[model samples]
Target: MIAIIADDLTGANDTGVQYKKNGYSTTVKIMNDNDVSSSMFKTSDVVVINTDTRPLSKKDAYDCVFKLAEKLNSVNNLEYIYKKVDSLMRGNPAPELEAILDSTDAEIAIVASAFPDNGRIVTDGTLLMPDNKHVDITNIFNTETKRKAVNVRLINVREGAESLKQYMEGQMENGADIFVFDTVSNEDLATISDAAMLIGKKKIFCGSAGLAKQLGRKKKAEQKYDGTVFIVVGSRNAATAHQVRMATETFKLPVVLVNSEEIIDGRYEKAVSESVEKAKEYYLNGNKVVIIAIDSLFEEYTVVLRATATENAKSLKVAESLGDIVKRLYEHIKPVTFVATGGDTAFQICNFLGSDGMELVDEIVPGVPIGILREGMADGSSMVTKSGGFGDEDTLVKVINYLMVNRK
Candidate 1:
């Protein structure tokens, strides 16, 4: 039985769902005494525990994971453990990694966070994404303002597993706790996975959802949605705004604008009632892709003016309203493909639609992923997600084209 440990609810859901998609009955446990249902253990082949310790201090976080690791270690059927970290390298990975290392016989922890499909790659010990940039390791974890800088070493995968082992041993001698493995593609990830599994001593795996997907690849359902696709655009970024415009003008995709400002005024419920019906009409009238955006012109400008910390809460309300619109339309139309852009908006929609987690099947674009949910919808209903600033002007139209030409 595989066990996945995550820092947040969404991370647990998304990573665990990947295993579920691959035919393992998976459960995302809330990790509370009264909440961990016994039936979940009986039904799931994999049990994912959400520690919910990302926001905690280093000591607290370490203690939380240590306790959980101890509990899992007691389980007779528990196999190797997977420590899930954020894809963007957010949150504290070292403390939790240390807990896993201390609890298990695992001599080394493999830290591979390269999700090439999501356009994030680690090459030569530096994160190579957003234009071949490496993380600023020197200042990242130095919370104490006056602490001396810690030097980190990057070992290339081309150096082979022996070289990696020697380098890790050297790092251990020098007191380095974590190491990042470089990967440029899916093949590279598979190679790394194989090498880690072949380690002489026991090992613990640490990475984002990408590495988990690679390690747990199996024959599962193929998710394809060539039918009506609904595109939900909630990003106020100019890049997304331009993409929305290009998609409608270049592809003639139907557009339905929701008054997001109304949400801030406590009128979101009133707005969704109309948007959902219009979306239904638009889809039924022979439009293959329907673009649901906020009043783009207003969003384009107000988003700039609302750039203060005080206004962020209000901005979230607008995001929530946009999510509600998408949820209503999705349930009403049951569109084959659900495309949601912007992180907050996408999370809200997934929450409403009960997309506890999804199995990643394809990349609509680099860093823009399309996948099938493990539950809460039709088997093949494809769900696509994108960051607010991920793509270019023609990205949206190109996604629709990909869906059209590559039907399963």
Candidate 2:
């Protein structure tokens, strides 16, 4: 009788699948904002949390875990402990849980994966960050001095474009040579040719979503950007990130992994702002800026703003804040193309642009809607009346992948 808590549907499914495969009697629940009763706690022996059963904020997730623990501990003082699984592992642990576990005396185990030898967590844990240090993209870039030539493929849209802009700036500051391909059409060969002309080196190529799949089909060492370092940003562990990694490896491209979970850590708002500012600075310093956002999800904070707003006044206030940020950002660096990701972001952007509503043309990314804004909407009219299909971790992955690979 093992309890498995998931933060989302995908995590719940994945964890349930793994436990079933391992011959464990597991019950995976997609957690909502609620308390777990003591009776629910008495049913399981080994609980696996896939970071899905809770919200995005670490504080919220930690609070939920604490509540769960309190409810469970009352029934049976089960030896409470925290466990971390790797990106390659079947169970994906939430970062917030890792933080909560760090604060407790409960036994922590890093089962199967290599644990950080000198990390804050002791050796008793199975998996650890390399060298016991939190992995940072900034540190990775600074460690290498020789300029590496890389090609970046941006899908192009609005949502998390600022993060990519910031990452590109960071790479340029670290003296890495970068080439960007603004392709929303999934034309990999064309993008490769464009990248060849821009940078003239074929060492690395970074892309996301459909772009990664396009690259995956090519013969290894056959394209203009052969033996490239491939990076994919702004997707989930199962979806874009995993696919891109496989494609890069299959095509014999050198790969450096950067997930969104790794980018902001606990300070999401600050990270987003910092990334946007960095991109602006890079553009001002005379570097070419190529931002690729597949859709409106690139500007997720805007979506969050819309989601947080229940009333028209609240929505207007949030939209006004977003408008200010966008205006300031555009003043510094105007992206060549603003690609919108999901329908919600597109609607919000269109609303911001004084459109009525967007038309649903296609679902660009699976489980995400892509649409065009309707004509003749009044200015300041709220388009995103209610928010749906927003996955914080998935969105974070998408943002980070774009930044890490596209960084100059």
Candidate 3:
């Protein structure tokens, strides 16, 4: 039996569904009560706890995990345990839990988000890579453009920051000019307008459908940006992309609408291959390339692979095969820089490069987790992998902007 606990029903459901699909008889329980007994824990072979709802202080979180581990210890049948804390900033006790784990001989895996306010020690989480069978697009760039400083901005919406980071890094050998600004309300839009005035360049605003609609209503004459590209990328339905495209066109911006499904489709390998061909042409034509991908992971690719593969042996085989493919591809492209998002993607890429497995390095800002692989340190060959994760779409865009401006 596996017990998964979360602060809210949504997080529990998401994590539970994954475990269930992985052939485990899982039970998802909301963590409302403070007291859990060994007898209660003995019923499950594995236990998962969500630490988001509890107070985030190191001592508080440590107490909760310590008690839970004590309860699991009483149940000799417990083989594996996982604890998930949703937010790092909202009083997560990850540091205390790590310290306690170091001292104890507990068989447990802990995963947590390191929101900006949280300290470094508590931010580290286990990295899980996808199976080898899946194909991933690392750094994808288009033709070189004459523009020296490209301004990439995202409206403060859902999951945009992380998505934008992947897309921008994919498009250029080096990261593009990126900026993160809030556009959730009128005040954010005004702030963006003020910033645009200070740094005048070609500004591309990326956002979901809802944010694009809000911007449409504002119609602030001063908010117009030169060479503005509105990228409509989100996990929502196709309707959202269409709506954003329409709104951006109303402003007469050079909008390039991208369908999230098209980019993230299982056929990503093929789509990216074609995109790369186009990029080569653009590069040959002397245009600086800027590529942006948003909201790529709606459904976990791991679940999809597990469902498609006939057996666990086949799943592992496919994952290994994918590693080989990525290894060969990296050798060929030799990109100057690479950026990735999410634990699974980072792990898979690192494995492909035959690097010292995947490790959570640091949090670039709040809600964004960065994973790094040192240059020339992998087993097979040296490959560079720079990736980060944002919990939602809005943050995805923020990361893209941050990278665009800061890319060295």
Give the candidate number with the greatest TM-score.
1
**Of models 2 and 3, which has the larger lDDT?**
3
Which residue pairs collide in model 1, if any?
Answer: none
Query: What is the Cα-based lDDT of residue 71 in candidate 1?
Result: 67
Error of 1 at 192 (Å): 3.9
Clash totals in order: 0, 44, 44
Candidate closer to the true structure by TM-score (higher is better), 1 or 3: 1
Model 1 segments more than 4 A misplaced: 5-76, 91-108, 123-134, 138-156, 182-191, 200-202, 213-221, 224-227, 236-246, 295-312, 354-382, 389-398, 405-408
| Model 1: worst 10 consecutive residues (lDDT sum) | 143-152
How well is each residue in 1-408 modelled by candidate 3, as lDDT tens digits?
A: 433434322233334333333333333332434434444444333344433333234455556656655554454544334343333122232343343344346422112222222121210112122222221100000111112223233332123434543444443445434222322233333343344333323233221111111221221111111111112122222322343334334433232222334433355455445444543443345432223234332333222211222443333333333343344444544332333332233334455664532122223333332322333334322111211222332443443454445443
Give candidate 3's root-mean-square deviation (CA, Å): 22.4
User: What does candidate 1 score in Cα RMSD to the true structure?
Assistant: 5.4
Error of 2 at 334 (Å): 48
| Candidate 2 C-alpha lDDT tens digits along 1-408 | 334444433223322333333333333332332534445445444443334322234456555655654443444544333232222122223333333333444322111121111111212212223233333222222232122433333432122445444544455566545333333333432343233324322222221112212222222111011111112122221323333344334433332221233232444355346545644554555543223222222332211211221343333333333333333454454322233322223333443454433222222222222222234332221111111222232442343343334333
lDDT for each residue of candidate 1 in 166-273, tens digit (9 for 90 to 100)? 656666677554556667777766666766665565667888767777756564544556777888877776668888888888887788888776777788778777
lDDT scores for all predictions? 0.66, 0.32, 0.33
Rank order (by lDDT, best first): 1, 3, 2
TM-score of 3: 0.31
Best by lDDT: 1
